[model samples]
Target: MSDSFGFGQRFTPDEMASIRKSLRDEARFGSEFIGRLKRVAKRIPFAEDLLAAWVCTRDPSTPRRVKLTLLAALGYFVLPLDAIPDVMPLLGFTDDAAVIAAALAAVAGSITQQHRDKAKEMLADL
Candidate 1:
């Protein structure tokens, strides 16, 4: 069967490779997200949304494909190098923010109030 109900349509080889890389980098996201968040929290305007996405990703009830998409964006955020190197002033995290915004828009319905609340709580503690 060629059906991909839960995951949408099948990916081409290059797309599949990127997905695989995202999955492989999930641990990196988990490990680096907090530290990176702390470092750039003051600079990033969307920290709450980012934390909500992280909360959604960790929720057992979240769909796998949603998790995959969020992880891909989160993974990109933590990468040492990306479309725009993240060390530059002002423009550094624009690409990361764009990627994250796209992922959140794609899975907006899946991110619940509970996730948002948890994210807010985390932000308060931070």
Candidate 2:
């Protein structure tokens, strides 16, 4: 009955509420998070490679649904439109990070050494 099987135990109702609140507040903190992500993203040379690794690791071997979910989450980051506009303050990027983290956790097994290596290579600049 619990979400223990996925993403380190599904978030509790309270946790989910907190996450929602964080998203709401992110409008005020969006800029900071976006800046952080930009800094991090900039360090990685092969962002696509890391993303490929995430896809391979997180989704089931034949994961159509999970793939869609990941794509949607990724789109949320790249797209300008969302519940909280990316231009907001510190919290703007919290949701993006949370979603990406959740997706990564979901497919942790798929993220192999190769993926990590690629990420490391890209991030070496940082």
Per lDDT, the best of the predicted structures is 1
Candidate 1 lDDT over 1-126, as tens digits, reads 243334456557786588777567557657688888888888889899889999999999987878778877887887788999878899998999999998888788899999999999998887
Candidate 2 residue runs with Cα over 4 Å from true position: 1-66
Highest-scoring model, TM-score: 1
lDDT of each: 0.83, 0.52
- TM-scores, in order shown? 0.83, 0.48
Candidate 1, residue 24: the lDDT equals 72
Q: Where does model 1 exceed 4 Å of error?
A: 1-8, 22-28
lDDT of 2 by residue, 1-126 (tens): 433235435446785564454445434434543444456575433354435544343435635434444544554565556666656766666667666777666765656666576556545553
> For model 1, how big is the CA root-mean-square deviation?
2.9
